[model samples]
Target: MTQTLTVRRSAFTVALTLPVLATALLALPPGTAAAAAPASGSAIEWGPCAGMSGLDPRQQCGTVPVPLDHADPSGPRIDLAVSRIASGKPAARRGTLLIIPGGPGNAGLHEPSRRGRQLPQSVRDAYDVVSFDPRGTGRSAPVSCGLAHEDLAMERLRPWPAADGSIDANTATARRLADACQAGDTAVLRTMSTRNEARDIDRLRQALGERKLSAWGVSYGTYAGAVYAQMFPHRTDRWVLDSNDDPDPARVARGWLANYAVGVEDSFPDFADFAADPGNPDRLAARPGDVRPLFLALAARLDREPIPWPGANPAQLNGNVLRQTLLDSLYTKQRFPALARLIAAARDGGPLPAPNTPPDEAMQNTVAASLATICNDVDAWSGEGQAVYEKDVADSRARHPLTAGMPVNVMPCAFWDLGPSEPATRITPHGPSNVLMIQNERDVATPLAGARELRDALGDRARMVVVDSVGHAAYVDNGNACGDAKVTRFLLTGERPARDVYCAA
Candidate 1:
């Protein structure tokens, strides 16, 4: 199914609520909180935001200066674009709540106003909602590799292997992208690791005059939040990590990339069931049992003979493109029609769906930042060249064909220009018991298994609320009131479920 080709950005929208601090801290003197204030500095000089849409007029924008490399606190600094909507009831305000976005590259400057709108009025009145564009994204100092239009497309950017599980194209593409990024702005690119992002958040906190800040982090933001909690436990007030990631420091980004294999397998059945429902206007099969084989056959046929698709960067409806579309459409139920229609069009030899075309610059910035963080956060890439990747791809394809071995395929990280400045921070149980994790039963990006890894790592410091729902997020977008209510209650009242619990859909 050909759709308007938008610059492929890898991010999902999610809402969040937070937990209260350690019980011991609750006993502190009412007048003073130990980690409640940072070194005093000039107050934020708020001004009208320009070019950003869907934000309240009252939403104010500003910037904070942070060391480009936290190692040198006095070294060169960079500006981080931040936005905030002050508490409507200052007397009732609990403190500041930082909203962290999903993608390692996604901009969250509008989140304070966007997601804030969905939050309960009590939660809103209790905190100053805030978010920002991470180091190399959005209104902050952005970076780009100036990748070719084709390279920037979602299908190509995801490293999907050619149909027979061959990774020849993936390897060459990885090298091309890695070289371009290395040749671009090396300094800024090198500073774009999860660790640096966490540090940047700390800097933002200090600049905001909050010694400790509460946070609601989603997707990749969950990882960044975990690192922050691990590195600066005392600096955290309340933390809500939604759709968690595995905190395996050794496999940092590599594990996340590879997790697509399990994630797709875990979530595809939901899509299949949807596609085969006779009542579905866009149903693709007569029965749920027939959906999988039908999709596999159609994908194979496209692999053998692609249809010409004008206006798209690659200009053809190839097998990998269809596969990429399938992966994307599974993210949420609303996108199911796009996939079903694409399949119907492809099967019936009709015109492909129009793709959503985002500006080229937006694509460049997102792709560059994603690569920088994944590559700089850890040394997971084997650097063993094409032959090894080929073997891994073949093996993965045999086991999980739905993913076409792309999850295990080579990426630019194998050829990254720089290594992690420091090892990825290991998440542990040493932090205060201030974290509450909420996850959907099936998530395409961050799977439940990975969420479990994080939960295990946090041990007694956290409680997880598992939602009996499909798709990525457990909050706003996913229609699970049971899950939403639990999360909302916890954030609003500092009340967590006594133990791990499940919320039925």
Candidate 2:
């Protein structure tokens, strides 16, 4: 079976000891249709959440309605699945703290409860932690392209080109996915841009009766949070964007996708060190310098002679699949062993491991929502021909073989049938100066360079903490004590670093 990319980035969390709030009723009125719209001043009738086991019993689930198209206020409306864990001590309560999840498609509905567990007592006591599923995600009117199970595979969705650096198959996949999304549901799909999500957030704040919202947004959520700050500056309180993204309006998602090249290169040395450590049980190489070459050679060999594996996507282990696995595993240190095991097994011609397969319907929704957002967030790529993409991919492959030219490869956005409803929102220093950024020095998703770009764009409005750690995100997960301390302090007391500072790993 061909291994498919099934690794999804995780939400960052800390291991702080905080008081758990008492069990409370779920919010939002009964008979609320999944797509029901709420009035601006309408209060969510608090009620028991169903289906989420191990979640805090006090975590309440509700829905907020926002205009499907913000322009047509009185037109069609869509529901946003929301959850909240109110501050335990109202006497010390400050205000609302929104916990934005990563991924354009990742559901934030349970993030508040999950992440809230890691917050310091003071921080948890200071504000209500809340999160929501964006317009076309999860319980918020979930949408799918009705795509085939194979089409929904992460390997297929991520556009890993042919081994020869040819984008012919990639281009075809892009067109197929794009066409499927466009032909499926125009209303929800076309409305799944970042701008709309940000607007939906504001509507949520209003429904909660909060004048301003403080937020901790991670990964792609950082971009959404920045957009929210830019669009509704007065509505923002203390904002912390961890593992930031480049807010270059000209290249939104495209820039992020491209940064994977630099990101992987920047973080590969860390992986090399691990792979070469003699103490490591699954070390892939005897010397640190040999790891990269070994990985590249292994991938090339697989490209030439794909190993047959039953039960996995495509039923074979090809080079790009291995590359995808490597890229996904690089997201965190804990995931290193998975990649090492694969490399060690492959080196011995051992049996391939069983692949992780997420529910097809879930991936269908995720990929569809992700594509819709990226394609509609900005005017990034054009419907260029395969030759153009092939040349670009070939050049990138030569320049950065670690990524196998996948970073610059064509994706559904290139052949997207829809365009942004408006130009991408430009993030500026014009917002509140309460923004604080925490980033890892070696992030495989959003690199340090991109975080610097965002810091530069935010100007005096933001200050960044560069953690000397390796991996994605900085606060809580994949970050050191110094970094986590600084972020927690800022979240609790609004005391940001006097100037940009570095936290040694």
Candidate 3:
């Protein structure tokens, strides 16, 4: 999973939402009108998943039925698919921990199974780890915009401007996508956002019979978890916000989109280093200095004349494709080979290999959810005049040649006709002082800079652990034993740094 730099970026999606980590359970808040949740059964029921199957008798999965509207519980109800890995040490178990995944589009329903092996045993023994797909996502009732095949392509969906820096195409795409979503089954799509997700979490809490929930929220999920804690402080417990994002109350998703430029700058060097490594089978350069020029020249060539790639989703190596590729490759160290291969193939005057395309069903659900959350979070139509964005897009193309004009261009939100379903919930500092933030020094999607904003917003309620790393999401992507140890230690016990801790690179 990558940081969707978006245009629904692939490969570069790994900002937070890592495998597992620790954080102690917390007690709920007092002197507040926190509503009591619904009645829930006491046990987890087992089932099979793509990960470790029935062999792990402790793991169970089921659909936790919830109302489409919590205000009207008797109204139309939808089911949220869920998975739980019950406490291995029942005697030592304290409570439940919710695994909040990043990506407004990303779902964590499979996490308990996918990451059951990664959790430290003490953390595992103490809590029944649970994760779920938010509404309009996996196993839950999903929304589809009925976009055309070409419209589903990453570049088009993300509103990457024309190579000439013209937004005429972007405007058209916005209209088309907006019309498609509005004309299709949009009831669910219209209602999706971080605010609703917070409501949904509360319902899940009631359904699970847990008095309080300890959470491990990553990337986009960190924002969601923060909003949840603010709205229902009494229900939250020891929370871990790893690889955090900006809580720019006004431009939540837009801020997320703009972070791509810094993200690329922060990460491209890693790609360059990997491309220059001596033994790399697909080394693009023998020295780090040569990698940037090589990528830039290749991208410019592709922009003027795209490489033919029939059968691929977008079917060409145009400027945005190159830009999109650059964003995707920055998420992980292992992806250096991919950037090198793409550059080599394009430079050799040959057809670039087909890029990965998720199944139509998966892509549709992802796009729909991504759009819904962004649109519903805040009005993205920056009405500050397209001049700034257009000029910025051009400047971005010149500055960050790898991303072309995608990061700074107009998006569907710019031309959207709808207002938010609800205002973004404010992340108040008046909650439990149980938040532990772990972030990498350089993150492409949710950069460390944004994490600091989140840390500041939380004030005294959270502790910071900045790992001297260059990738997005630290716990898993950083591969730093020191950073990993700090998080695992805090989660197993209620221990925390007396002040902000920074791990050496």
The reply for model 2, stretches above 4 Å from the true place, is 1-42
Model 3 worst lDDT run, 10 consecutive residues:
1-10
Which residue pairs in candidate 2 collide?
Answer: 1-309, 1-310, 1-315, 1-316, 2-315, 2-316, 26-47, 27-46, 28-45, 94-126
Instruction: Compose the digit string of candidate 1's lDDT tens values, residues 233-344.
Output: 7788777898988889889878988898898888888988999997999999888889889988888999999988877767888888888888877778788888999899
| Cα lDDT tens digits for candidate 3, 1-505 | 1111222211121122211112232433221223223225553344765453433566677777777765567999888878888886767787777899788988777777666567778888878889988999877887778777888888787767776677767766776687677776666776687877988887888778888788888889899999887777767667788889899887888888888887888888888888899988988888998998888877777779887777667887787778777787778766767778888888887556667767777788888788878876786554646566677888887886666767777777664544464456555566567778999887889888888889998887788899887766777555788788877776666566778899997
Positional deviation of 149 in candidate 1, in angstroms? Answer: 0.8
Compared with the true structure, the alpha-carbon lDDT of candidate 1 equals 0.80
Model 1 worst lDDT run, 10 consecutive residues: 1-10
TM-score top scorer: 1
lDDT at 189 for candidate 3?
A: 77
Q: Highest lDDT: which candidate?
A: 1
The C-alpha TM-scores of every prediction are 0.91, 0.90, 0.88
Two-way lDDT contest, 2 vs 3, winner? 2
